[model samples]
Target: MAYISVLKLILSVYCFFTLFILCSTAPELCNFPAIFNFGDSNSDTGGFSAALFSLPPPYGQTFFHMPAGRYSDGRLIIDFIAESLNLPHLQAYLDSLESNFTHGANFATSASTIRLPNRVLPCGSGFSPFYLNVQYGQFHQFKSRADFIRTRGDIFGSLLPREEDYLRALYTFDIGQNDLGEGFFRNKTIKQVYASIPDIINQFTVDVTNIYWVGARSFWIHNTGPVGCLPYILTTFKTAGKDSAGCAKAYNEVAKYFNLKLKEAIGQLRKELPSSAFTYVDVYSVKYSLFTHPKKYGFELPLVACCGYGGKYNYNNEVTCGYTLKMKNGSEIVVGACEKPWKRVNWDGIHYTEAANKFVFNKISTGAFSDPPRPLKQSCFNPS
Candidate 1:
């Protein structure tokens, strides 16, 4: 009788332990019907290309087999995100041809800044006129216009997202890098740049608030990456102190400062908007890891552009990638991509290759780098 009682007790304990494990580890995923993305080239599907001019070939050769309006050699992190959620890739809101927005729309454009720029692209400033505020305005217009178009009951209605999806959509942001770059390009002092971060974050907060008012509840915001580690900053600021990994130390510190402020602002937003779910993704850490430990990630030439013109970092502002340059001897040469882009981190001095972006997406999607430690699929779960 005693042996039988002991056996029963052990069985009960084992069952309890198994149940606890199953309950704790079971997946708690959010069913986000759509994704409304906003930002710069980091997540731009084709906004810049549609709004301005289409990018030349070799831009999307790795994945899309042609210029797909992305700056990288293939898909961006946003593309991986959409794929993970089982949703169709978002079409640029600015794109009119061959676009379908049933799942959602992308409002990101290359060279976009959180703050308005004094000058824009093609005019030599290299910044996009569609800044953060302008993106918000576009989104506001899209919301109303899409609803209006859906009422028409035609093929266009099928292409637009369902009205209910707006409330359940995952709102993503990947801007602010260009704001810092803009300041640096203007030769602003580090202190001046530091001082400008607050206003920049405030602008971001206001747009987010406006978006919230428009029924967006789940927000997944990405902090700016390591600007100092990029080939553009490294080659431009030759005198900046280099870390052991070859990244510029001072510029990286400035980026860190911006991220710190942005995180704090997010915390405040959580308080102010109690009903919303906010996920702060530390992409800077993930991206910086590539520079610090490139070999661990199966990458080489971490700071060199894979598809840029002649230079120490294989980048040139004068002769950018895919641009045809005329030599003095009347010969024309087109700057082309390297033989292997998968083994490289930087794509064209300003963006990450598809491999690097995939690595980043894999890391951050695991929730290890999120503020609340929630996976990408579970981002809508509010801990507060």
Candidate 2:
């Protein structure tokens, strides 16, 4: 009898442990029907670079083994987010020749802007002279992108008719960093640009609200990261006493101010679009944490870029990373990468590596940056 009782106790304990493991690992049911992504290089799959005439290496070497037009190695935050939801990486609307939009699409561009066009210039001039021209052009691109979606929606709707029932989807907007980097910071003083953040964010809110009116039911918006910490800023503007370890307080503070206002703007949007779900993903904090606590996140080099000349910028924006190499005495001369690529934080002066993007995606999906009232919960589940 004693032996039988001990056996039963052991069986019960085993069952309990099994149940706990299953519960912890089980996937949650995804509430979203689809995902729509709009942003710059951080989330852009291959839209802008593909559109451009120039081809650069070291662009997609991290993931695709060749340049896929993505700025990172393999996948980005949006790609990971799609995977977490059991969805494929968002397709570029431009690449939708057949209009098969079963999983939604990405309409982001590397150097795109959200503001209205201020002027118009001839095509292939390298830059869109005015904000209005770029805005209208991008809007047209967005419309073209949507046409592709409609085509896919029509086909998918016929096959999976219930998809429309869950038509409510998540849309992530992650742009504006370039506008600051190229436009404001390039010419104006940090003080001047800092003063204009409210205006920029306000206009962004309006643009996002318009997107919401179109078809975005759930939104994930991201604010700018700490620009001062970027390799370009650190190298170009570092004071005599301020080293790479110490970032410019003023620049970081401005980013904080912008983030605060952005949070407020999101709050207002939530109140205005009460029926829709809007979540803000704080990219600033995630990237900053990587720099501040590199060891905690398993990174060793926080400030250095994996590709680029060993200089202030740590990047040659005019040239691609791995694909293009200058030869000296029959030896290739290029930016040196860290010994442990995965352990480094910054891939280039401005971008994160595939691993870093994965880390950021996990945080966003888990509600590390979500606002209250609609925090992220489990995303999948398995009955077995």
Considering every candidate listed, which one attains the maximal TM-score?
Answer: 1
Local accuracy by lDDT, each model: 0.93, 0.65
Across residues 1-384, which tens digit of lDDT does each residue of candidate 1 receive?
Answer: 999999999999999999999999877788999999999999999998998978998899999999999999999999999999999888999999988889989999999998888678879767998898899999999989989998998888998889988888999999999999988999998889999999999999999999899879999999999999998998899899999989999999999999999999999999999988999999999999999999998999899999998778999888888999899999998989999899999999999999999999999999999998989998883443
- Report the backbone clash tally of model 1: 0
By lDDT, the best candidate is 1
In model 2, the Cα lDDT at residue 38 comes to: 74
Error of 1 at 241 (Å): 1.3
lDDT of 1: 0.93
Instruction: Please list the Cα RMSD from the true structure of every candidate, rounded to 1 decimal place.
Output: 1.9, 6.1
Question: Could you give candidate 2's per-residue lDDT for residues 1-384 as a string of tens digits?
Answer: 999999999999999999999998765545666666777777777666556533365555666777676776567888888887787777765564444455666777666555642332235323323232343344445545555555775553442213342235667778767666654444677778777778878888777776665545667777778776777667656572343455656667777887888889889987887767667778888888887888998987677777667565466554435544566667666544555667776776777788888887777676767675233433211123
